[model samples]
Every structure is written in structure tokens, then in C-alpha cells.
Target: MKLNTDASVGEEGWIDLGVVACDSAGRVAFSAARRVRAFWPPEVAECKAIHMAVRLAKAQGLANVIIESDSQVVTTRLTTAALYFSDLDTILGDILEICNGFNPISFTHVKRDGNTAAHNLARAVPFGVEQCWENHVPRDVAPYVLMDTLSLD
Candidate 1:
């Protein structure tokens, strides 16, 4: 499975996080959009998005997955297993722990343009709500998902 994730911060300091997982054929496996209270920086929000992706994959019984994010800092930290000295340390640790549940998992950084599906999903999510789609595409994110499938083809 390939999971693309992204996060956006609203003007009022709320964070919208999204994760979209697709199979080799580009079929949507799982997708989630969540609103989280703001306290940390954008990098932390990115980490949250990725952590959610790992959890979703595990819940769906996927043993191997490649998690992609548009945030280079978050991806680099996770991929290198670097020890962060700040509040991110805890979130990073949690991400690493989540990875342990999978037989094989990898993290990669991607350009924001390449992560449009997750971007749109994150942007569309209303604050204070957590919505998820499993085994099918949500109507609001369908166009973006189609674009992803086209690009993969």
C-alpha cells in the first residue's frame, strides 16, 4: 500500500490532517480527515498526519506500506530515526512505535503537488470533526482521488 498524507493549519490555529491510502492499482483502501486543536507547529501537524496513516494501515491489516508526506522535515526525521530535542520528540517516538506494528514500512518526502489528494482532503475537512472513509471514496474527495489514480497509471 502507498499512503499519502498532508496537514493544513487554519487561521484560527486549528490543524486539519488527512491520510489517503491506495493499493498498487490506485484503489482507495482507507482515507481519513481529522481536525485537531492547535498547540504545536506545522511540523507537528505533519507528523500527526503520518502517524494517523500508520494507524489506519495497521487497522486495515496491511503489513507493508510506504507513507508519503509533503513535509520534508517530518519525513526526514522519521526516516532517519533522528532524536528530536523538542516537543516533537514525543510525537516522533509515537510514530516510530506505530511503525513497529507493521512488518515493513517506509517514509518518503514528496512535493506538495504530488500529494494533492491528501491536500484537498485536509483542506475540505471542517474544524472539530473527524471523518473517515474506508473501502470507498468519499464524494468530496473523489475528483482528487481520480487524479491520483490517473497519475499512477
Candidate 2:
């Protein structure tokens, strides 16, 4: 599975985390959006998105996945030996722990332009509830999914 995650801040200053997983065929395997009320930086929010992504993958019984995030800082940190001390340390630690469940997993960085599906999903308003879509994505994200499919052509 190719899992992509992103984070957006709503007008209410709520952090919205979005995660989307697709099969090799570009079909959505699972997607999720969550709204969090916190005063975290964008990088922190991105880490939370990744955290949620890995946890959700475990919940869905996925044994392996290539996780992607738009935040270069976070992904770079995850792939490097040097851990910068900050709020992200704990969250990154937890993410790495959950990542152990998979036989092999990877964290990659994608440009914002290439991750529109998760980008738009992060802007979604789930009203303090974490919304999830299985076997498909919400309507708002379908166009981006199609865009992704076309790009892979």
C-alpha cells in the first residue's frame, strides 16, 4: 500500500490530519481525516498525521506499507539517525514503535503538488470526529484520486 498523509489548519485553528492509502492499481484502500484542537506547529501536525496513518494501517491489518508525507522535515528526520529534540521526538518515537508491526515499511517525502488527495482531505471538516472511508475515498477527494491515477499512467 502507498499511504500518503497531510495536515491542514482550519479556520478555527483546528489541526486536520488526513491519511490516504492506495493499492498499486491506484485504488483507494483506506482513507481517514481527523480534526485536532491543538496549538502545534505545522511540522508537528504533519507528524501527527503520520502517527495516525501508521496506527490506522495497523488497525486495518496492513503488514507493509510505504508511508508518504508532504513534510520534508518530518520524513527526513524519520529516515535519519539524528533526532532533533522537540515536541516531535515523542510522536516520532511512537510512530516508529508502531512501524515495527510491519515486515518492512518506509517513510518518504512527497511534494505538496504530488499529494493533492491527502492535502484536500486534510482540509475536510469532520466536526471533531475522525471520518474514515474504506475501499474508497470521500467525494471531495475523488478528483485528486483520479488525478493520481492519471499521473501514474
Scored by lDDT, the top model is 2
Candidate 1 similarity to native, TM-score: 0.94
Clashing pairs in 2: none
Please give, for residues 36-134, the per-residue lDDT of candidate 1 as tens digits: 878768888998888888887888889989999999988988889997578887899998997898878889998988898999888767767878888
The TM-score obtained by model 2 is 0.94
**lDDT minimum window of 10 residues, candidate 2:** 79-88
Model 2 lDDT, full chain set? 0.88
Worst 10 residues of 1 by lDDT: 123-132
Residue 96 lDDT (model 2): 85
lDDT of 2 by residue, 73-117 (tens): 899888773466777898988888898898788889989988999
Clashes of 2: 0
- The alpha-carbon lDDT assigned to residue 30 of candidate 1 equals 83
